[model samples]
Target: MQDEPTPIELTKAVADFLRSDITPLITGHQAFKLRVAVNILDLVTRQLTQEEGSDASEVERLRALLGMDGSVTELNRALAERIAKGEVDLATPGLAEHLWATTMDKLAVDQPSYASYRRELSRGE
Candidate 1:
């Protein structure tokens, strides 16, 4: 196993440092670039923290919905194909819940702070 200071922790530390310390010192286009860098770091940290669990849950949901086993990507492709062929639809058992879970996981990584996302999360939907 790895030692202390995991990737998520390290990334958060760097992002915090940049946002609190260096950002105030930068200016103009460089400031914008630094802000972008901080955002990237924050996103990376969130992924590092959440990706494994979210992906595993997604794969599990996909397997249950599709009644087959495959990697997440393969299962998703199979699902899309089935959907396109009219083999599956919103009426399928667990389909809507699976889609919602998958979408929430994506939003958790990509836009956890988005208004709608935050509202939905707060509502525990």
Candidate 2:
């Protein structure tokens, strides 16, 4: 790995700079696009920082729920197949909790400011 600032840190810094500096100077469509760009950068930073831990937790939950060993992608596919066949679902032990955790992790990265996400996050604490 490289030294000093991580990729997430660099991206976050750039996004912060854009939000604090460039965003106020523009107007109309350009400003909207700039905001979108900054948001995208922030999302990327979150994913870079959070994905590994969230994915590992998801894999562990999947292994416990399914009683199998595989990569995260494989386990997820198996889970989806089982769900489609009515073999595994919310009624299954740990299923609902696992799904909720995964969804919350995604929302944390994708839209932390979303009202419902914020409410659920606070409720968890």
TM-score of 2: 0.92
| Model 1 quality (TM-score) | 0.91
Q: What are the clashing pairs of model 2? A: none
What would the per-residue lDDT of candidate 1 be over residues 38-102, giving only the tens digit for each residue?
99998899899999999999999998888899999999999999999999999999998998888
Question: Tens digits of per-residue lDDT for model 2 on 42-125?
Answer: 899999999999999999999999999999999999999999999997889999999999999999899999999998988864
Instruction: Say what the RMSD of model 1 is.
Output: 1.4
- Residue pairs with colliding backbones in model 1 are none
> Candidate 2 — worst ten consecutive residues by lDDT sum?
116-125
Q: In model 1, which regions exceed 4 Å deviation? A: none
Instruction: Tell me model 1's lDDT, rounded to 2 decimals.
Output: 0.93
Candidate that would win on TM-score:
2
